[model samples]
Target: MHSIHSTDAESAQNLTRYLADEEETLKFGKKLAACLHSGLIIHLFGNLGAGKTTLTRGILHGLGYSHIVKSPTYNLVEIYKISGLYLYHFDFYRFNDYSEWEEAGFRDYFNSDSICLVEWPEKAGNLLPKADLQCFLNMFDSGRNIEIRSSTETGKQCLIHWNTEKNI
Candidate 1:
């Protein structure tokens, strides 16, 4: 993995990196996991087969989850309890309308005691709450380019923590 850019502003912070392969992506995810906290909401943007699930798997692994981690495409969401934190992984790729989000009763999942990570969040429209952090993955000829941005103060703190922890 290569650091492309990193910037810190008053309200928003951005970090960009290049993942040369699947292993690097997972490693990056693991690094990100170390900086996660409860009540955080993250939006993941990527195309199909963009290694989103793989990255989440690495996060789970970093958080001491030993079982399988799969994309919640059909199930919409998967709940995992790791180190006393409730991590909700949601995929709205199959969503056709905003009502589906309301009907699923997922609003309650984004609480102060839990962390929410959503994929295909755009499909749900404005039903979901604003994400603290947004991660975008774009595919290139040899690998993937990941850009992580913090849209909230809490997210900025996490990014700052990640920057500090990653250097060591």
Candidate 2:
């Protein structure tokens, strides 16, 4: 496992890279999915082609969802039922106004029975629920950089578990 401690937010922002071939990335996502609980919100931040969807695909695969996973950019949300878990994958890329979040009544989806993974969450402003984990993805020349930050105590525990399990 790799461990680095930053004294400040800026230092914490220094990126880390994982050259996870598809298999490894899937494995990582699966590991993360296993630790998830309902009502968890994962905020994904990345520019175009940063592999957010790829990571989400991994998560779905890990959750035992065999169907094809596609970005919900146009549809706004995709609901998946897997092993009694309601996983909502949301992509707000096409969102033009924050009011749409309210108009769509998306806040109701943040209940204790569902897990939400939101891409382009910035588009929702304060309407969206608080995220448990914030995952930042960045594009490098050859691979991707992934940084996971815990927004809540549960998220911190999840990261600690992942670090231990994956020896990251």
Candidate 1: list runs displaced more than 4 Å: 1-12
Tens digits of per-residue lDDT, candidate 1, 67-121, equal 9998899999999999799999999999988899999999999999998999999
Give every collision pair in model 2.
1-167, 1-168, 2-168
Error of 1 at 103 (Å): 0.9
TM-scores for the candidates: 0.93, 0.87
Expressed as tens digits, the lDDT of each residue in 96-127 for candidate 2 is 99998888888888988999999999999988
The TM-score of predicted model 2 comes to 0.87
Each prediction's whole-model lDDT (CA): 0.87, 0.80
RMSD of 1: 1.9
lDDT at residue 16 of model 1 (Cα atoms): 79
